[model samples]
Target: METNHINQSPIDLESLISGLKTEDARNLKLMLNIQSMMWGIAAVYVFISALKFIMTTSWYDKLGGFLTLVAFVAFALLFRSYYKEYKTIDYGIPTIEMLKKAAIRYELFQWRGLYVLAPLLLEGIGLNLMMFDDFTNLEPLNRILFFQISYFFVMVIAFLVGYIIWKKRQKPLRDYALALLKEFQS
Candidate 1:
């Protein structure tokens, strides 16, 4: 075959990208869908719990419940947006564009992660408010210590679980997308 040095043929990107839209893609879509559903369920649960708290006469309880309700609802919306992003992925689009979207969407950490962090901070504040009236028998210092210790442990456990999930699931998919993007770009 003569090398057409002057009129080189364009790269056949379709064949190269065809493999990417298969198993991992399906799994990622499924994962996002499940995550969205779980968040929706969590939002509902929090909403119900908030309603219970709101029914009480205590102002602290009502405020705490409101914050918690807002946090969980935000979480549900955030995850839903993630699922919506997945839905927007068009395989028919250019491979590079598709990969770029996948890479950004699958990244465990990004500017958009602030959306997750904000709700978490709100939840923490709400929990503290809700629990402040509890364990009143303990000394003030002891109560503070108890709340801090328990909250720290719970947050640590939650962070570890989230990190594990990202590492096990999203990281690999993001890495794969980045690899393909890099390969094609170079």
Candidate 2:
């Protein structure tokens, strides 16, 4: 009589880590795309708004508003995609989980800061334009002042959020990478 035995293979930690790295790279690319799209939209909006101000007409106002709305929608979609990706990770894979958590924290900071601060800054600019009677009355000095103030506010908020996320995730990311390296060596 002959007996049959079943064979089991060990978990391929290197392959697992490689896969995690690939996923992280993909997520980073997506994040960069989202950021680029946001900046592009913002630049276009600023240009349109400036043209409207210089022309001293409400004709472009509707188009500007529509573009702003589209940008907001695009941001919302990106946020949702980020949230979904963050939630779908397998925590059993400790290193991958840590990386995913770091990504989630970064994305959360970006979403909150950009969504809240950008609109507030834009509203301030719109209000300033409304208060000025005409483009000629909005002197170069006044326009520069408004632009600088709003830019400062947005930059400060973005920097603060970015710093917080970096500080919070640095240790975890390092530990995760080290752990993965150890696993690979063993």
Candidate 3:
């Protein structure tokens, strides 16, 4: 059985801030690591796509190769931005103004990161379409409809996954920011 300790003293703001800051620092480190892994994953994906394009004679294949590179680079830049923002967040002791700034930037990061995922998903779909010759047989109207439906579906899925990831990182950072802000205000 789990024993619960009941009546306790008031919340210790200093201790709470310290604990939140510690968690934020840990989560920030994990985000940096995730960013590094993404770079490798993007590199490998681009390399494989390049090889596939080189082996194919179709003009569509060449276009797919170019799209792959563009897509990876774009997402990589977004991940890099997240890394840079976290690196500069001043996770150490901060003044009230600093916490305010960090809070705004963290919120901005969450929104921008979410938007980036949809485009990345779209680019992947575009490249896949180029590689598949089945689409060539479809009429222009049908092709457009097919792409529209697929893009919308893929983007919705990507946004949901991206939002979860952003929240995982954002929550800890936001908590730390709020704790600091509250302490400063008090």
Candidate 4:
């Protein structure tokens, strides 16, 4: 009786490293595209606000200014958070690689939620405030306060949704990372 043997080769470390580098490059490109899209949205917002200011001479402009400032602050915070997370992953500290990946995923979810929620919240506030101009019976202060409250509620909901998504996505990644670490150690 004759038996045939099949030979399998192990994965090459250099090839693994090259593959990782390519993935990193792709991630960097994706991050750049996300950033560009964010900036483009911001630019459009600024242009629209500038047009509103040029055309209107009302207290609505004050509300617009406040909303714009809020947007800028939120964007700055989100961008900074994203940059920090990106740096953590890009630096590749082997000890914390899994943690960094987890952080990146969380940050991405948070930023995405904020990106969707911010404009919705802003539009809600803007519309509510605009109604005040036409509704002479409503006090300006009351309208502003109502808009703020509504905005806060929307933000809370957005964060909750993001957190739920993050929690769901995190489990598999955590398990995979733990398994990888265990295998490496053994």
**What lDDT does each candidate get?**
0.79, 0.61, 0.72, 0.66
Cα lDDT for residue 183, candidate 4: 71
Q: Which stretches of model 2 miss by more than 4 angstroms?
A: 1-57, 91-137, 140-145
**Candidate with the greatest TM-score versus the true structure:** 1
Residue-by-residue lDDT tens digits, candidate 3, 155-174: 78977886797689876787
For model 1, residues 66-105, the per-residue Cα lDDT tens digits are: 7877787787778778767766678898989989988988
Model 2: per-residue Cα lDDT over 118-186, one tens digit each: 554554454544543445567757865866687678878978987787768765665666566567557
Q: Tens-digit lDDT track for model 4 on 20-93?
A: 99998997897778777777777777777677767778767657555754656576666757576646654456
Best first by TM-score, ranked: 1, 3, 4, 2
Maximum-lDDT candidate: 1
Which candidate would rank higher by lDDT, 1 or 4?
1
Model 3 vs. true fold: TM: 0.55
Among all windows of 10 consecutive residues in model 3, the one with the lowest summed lDDT is 1-10
Q: Report the poorest 10 consecutive residues by lDDT, candidate 4.
A: 1-10
